[model samples]
Target: MFDSSKRQIGFAPPSIDNECIAAVERVLRSGWITSGPELKAFENDLETYLKSPRVLCFSSWTTACELALRWFGVGPGDDVLIPAMTYAATANIVLHCGARPVMVDIDPIERVVTLEKLQAAWTPQTKAVMPVDLGGWPVDYKAIGNWLNSAPIRERFQATSAVQETFGRPLFISDAAHSFGAHIENMPVGTQADITGFSFHAVKNLTTAEGGALSFSLPSSLDLEQTTAWFRSMSLHGQSKSALEKTQSGTWQYDVVEAGYKCNMTDIQAAIGRSQLRNYPDHLNRRKEIAAQYTKALETVPWCTLPVLKDATRESAYHLFSIRINRFQSAQRDALMARLKEDGIATNVHFIPLPLLSLHRNRGEHMRHYPESEACFNEQLSLPIHLHLDDEDVTWIVERLCYHVGELMTPHA
Candidate 1:
């Protein structure tokens, strides 16, 4: 137990320390800040960490993934399969590309979209599929991949651009924003998808404050060097030469190849990410411990349905400790959260299903269509699981949760 006045446990706060500050200070003193050597080095480090062939950093996941949509030519009249349970960015990016986000319902237990749902939703106009790893639990990537490569499905794919025509199949882009360090079959999440985008927002496990990265494992038909250059150039207004390249003597002149978006990661951000990556494995371990503590304490509770952290083939990154209060509707769940807040503890819901949002609703998407997503949303409660917490804090949170839930479920005056 904690003194309410003295304890204020924030939900998913950034775990910045003296070392992280020092790294930023060094970058600040370096004089060159934007998209320079530090960014390149960070990408290389991420490549090694993720076991990816190559990785690229950008301002955020939305931009990096939207660029992928643009690069793959996902425009109007095309359909991109996505889960209704994901964050807005997943569907918003599809809409930004002038394509329809064919939202699919999640599996009741997995809380992630399945190959069957995607297959059922597929159409000749479906140009791509962007599945999210909701709450760090990866969707069935192998099953989805096998489906994409099946001869019957491949024959139905309609290629509207050169990039699409090359593979003769719909693109598989993973919305791995919350699953950066998660694994499937002992392999990291990045290599499984054709292109996997990772978010490094302040709350993420391996944050760059406000940054994201993409790891590519595109089909061999595409030229890696050329594709890498395309993304790099696009991130910087489609310029023929980078600021670093033009710094060479008598290399000032350059050409603008195409109108592009400006969403490059700066050196300062990279410095923070580099510092964090050095001890990421240890950070991951501590997070796992915290998750285990919660699971061990609550697994026996009749009303609690603990989130899956590991199984035979997949392991979560432990980004969020989202547990379900069985049979609790939105009102009771919110009341439990209120009780936790009164104790100076913070909690959150991972997301409101896409269909429930005004933007998606106006677009003709309805919450009723995604029964599993709505049901999951009603009971989902994401407990604080950050490095800022120690064993005692976790135990305290569990105690408060148990008490509040019991009170809510009990009949009282």
Candidate 2:
């Protein structure tokens, strides 16, 4: 048995090094640490990497989601569909705008908001469908787009629908916080949906301490420049010019265009983001290798269920290597976690289904209908899978996990 006093493996830690430190130092020395040149360079690099026309950085993913909803006109009386298993931020943004969040069950296999669930949940008030790329797996965007483009179905479902009638069509706003580099059919995640938001939290594949970005695929009828300008204004307290703009020579003039929230990413964060973006492809490859190793190590266990892998046309960023303990009760799952802790291995759960939480439950969201999410919550565990983990660490983690499973499977003590 492993000693509990030994140095414990961390679940996930920011993989920052000299590059990130140097970038931060440069920002501090530049005297333009706020949203300035570094922010612009980061945004440009992100746009090029994601192959999108526009990308706007924000302080966090929550703010990005809220701003996307606001700019896309998802406001009072609107209904935004989201997965029941995702982080609360996905639905909280909809609520922040006075809109209703219509929770949908995820696909059991993929653990993501699927087209079938979205179609089933479509209602007269449905304004937008937000599909979360859960655990870095990209959702089926082509299927969603095809469903939305069906003329007969759109006419039947779109007309008289509150959100659709108000916006002229149902919008697809993706919560892609977990999937910065994921792709589907060779198309990047950010550009798959009409509007997509990416998270660059410290624990993500790409880190900026804390940041997010929004990208869009504008409709032919909408003006991209105008939309981008409107979102930029909304991000900066609805002011025509930001602090950086006012500091420029002879540019000390601006106007308050509207009442909006303040949530802009500063140059200090963007400086780190630029370096991370440059190395993201390699980071993704390493993550994929780790995931493959986990699968190879754990698949033989009869009680283990591996995370979904990429098929012919879909690919994942491998952000999380989640495994479910088949036939394990909630108590058994808890015991396994405790045993892993004793063995100096760290583990985590991706999320607790939103409906089970006190805030949501108090708001009348019951957990009885979200069986898939509940089942996953009871049995799933996220293993360590970051750049920080080495081969020996991964092997030790797998061995400890297997030992615990073997113990749980034995006859009552």
Candidate 3:
């Protein structure tokens, strides 16, 4: 049933309420806007949300990841395993750190890296592995942790940083841009990995317009305060004093202890994030509710294979509601999306596997070895699942989708 009213259905969009607007306004009127109190409070709020020791906000998740790798001493001649079924940023950070990214395949069902695949991809040079939490569905860290605990793998780890020396194993970094506010087996995502990076991109479940944050979970043997300070310095051009600290009366002295990247979050962005965090529980719940609505309507559609929403072991943030049409090829998938566009609906694909991208392909990453990733790319489609979508919007999107799917699935007579 095509929309008769010319109603337009968009993909995910940010929810900017009046409260979010006022938050930005407050920051603007504060005079001192850059890296001020708002950003500090937002980091504190994120620290509380993740229940992790340290939370450092950044300009983007990409920088947050690169900085983490750098802090852990991942550099030239090292290898970092990244999931093939994810946005390039997951692997790109490894490249930016001057480490070779070993693109690995994922489990077909979960659309995320698994222990078996990781084991097969591991090499003596492997320094770390960044597991991605695709579409907000939490990765099974318990299984992954078991894989890391083995003596054989642990012995291969080369400790570079003071903190890495404590772990005695390759770092497990979670590229959890989609999984913020997500939990696995009752534990939050930030607690599941050695380091976790979250996205607050404009299109994410929670937006700071364009910002991200990192959470730390070092072994108890390491000093949390010392390590947190080190990361803060690394994000601010390795300066001894932050802009906020330097502003204090008669305290303008600072030094560039080491070369570092500039990736600090802005106060304006933090203000929006702070507002979003204030009602995060409700925001997260609304996303879950919308996911339930989609699942109930599309469950019986044979061609549609819904993404992993939640189970006993994990609860997703529901950032994206991606579906795999069981019988559709890439050509058919494109045609269905085109049909929906004609009906005033906008749809999109979650990702094109890294091996399929030119950067990785030129680096000798071949798609032939990643059959599961290729299969996912050919059939997957992301439907609208933001809080902005009302019941009518969702109902219409599903109806239009089913109609297009039927037309494509039916044998040409």
Candidate 4:
């Protein structure tokens, strides 16, 4: 157990300050709330922050992904390729769109979808590739973009939606729920993929308490405003006018365009998101600092393996510090976690690979089929990485972790 001086840590927590509280309070006090001035302002600020063609806010990452797929016209008889090692939301969104999600395995180290895997999984029925930025590290979309544009791959592409038809190619959708502040190819995530979705769940670096975003840079053939009009209508049960617009005197008349889902973000949540966005640069920097401290302390511990934060082209958002224990099985990982918990240090596993879950298993996506993904899942553990951790907390957490892991490696009588 940790010394009495330390407190029990949490794996992920929102960095809520007085300013964040004030932001949300302002929404509550305002007469206009749901998708009102605050949501609009947040979207506008995000537009400038991300420099995207557009940004659409949603209630959750699941809805943002599902809505984006639906917008791209992914439906029955189509296949969307996704990584086997992502949260179920990535594949679940594909299932919701009536498209079969082809479970593609990840590269051994990056634990992200690679062009080689995509090539193996490509089928004539494949209409989109939804590569998740697994844990905050952005995937290499430039290479994937090249592959999708190549004759060998593009020749088989079938346009499923109006947007797909306009592009004349398969969609490059990114399930980037963990990569809110990451960058790839000198571009933010919003520009890297044709469509990128972000999560602002409580555990995320940038939290809305609970919300998501859809940011994109579609081809010129796609009219950004026209598509956004459709998305605005679709997000709010196909309303022709937003709630705020309806508030204008003698302007209540509206129309339902597509029997859409009610997944629009509320002004209250947007207020929180805006506050987080304002602080994101610093929030992200602190996370980087914590990750660096962990690396410095653990790099010499042969049993400890730090996460990869950057490569030649991609840089992680530093959302999760998922360290792997060399040669440790799931049991050892769990034992170590229990030890950490006893020591007042909280930890978590980034994900249980989708293939191993009951839903995927029922769909015939068994873990045995994804040996590489299984290998990754068995050895990973995520430590706390957020604004809440101070210099002392990071040092204490790492010191306890290294000690516990070392003891586990010791020979027993």
Total backbone collisions for each predicted model = 0, 0, 0, 0
Per-residue error (Å), model 1, residue 299: 0.5
Q: The CA-based lDDT of model 4 is what?
A: 0.86
> lDDT at 248 for candidate 2?
85
Q: All predictions: root-mean-square deviation over Cα?
A: 1.0, 2.3, 1.6, 1.6
Per residue, candidate 3 scores C-alpha lDDT tens digits across 40-119 of 89999998888888888999999988888888889999999888889989888888888998888878899988888898
Off by over 4 Å in 2: 1-7, 156-167
* Clashing residue pairs for model 2: none
TM-score between model 4 and native: 0.97
Residue-wise C-alpha lDDT for candidate 2, range 1-413, written one tens digit per residue: 53435657888787887988999999999888889989999999989999998998999989987887776667787788999998988889898988988888877779997888888988757777888998999889889877776674566554333324444667888889999899888878888788898888888889898999998886666778887887788889999988998998999999996997888999999999998888889889999999989999988888899999698998998989989998677778889989988877778887888898887898899988888888888888899899887777788889888988898889985
Model 3, CA-based lDDT: 0.87
Model 3 CA deviation exceeding 4 Å by range: 1-4
Q: Give the TM-score of candidate 1.
A: 0.98
Q: Which candidate is the best by lDDT?
A: 1
TM-score of model 3 vs. true structure: 0.97
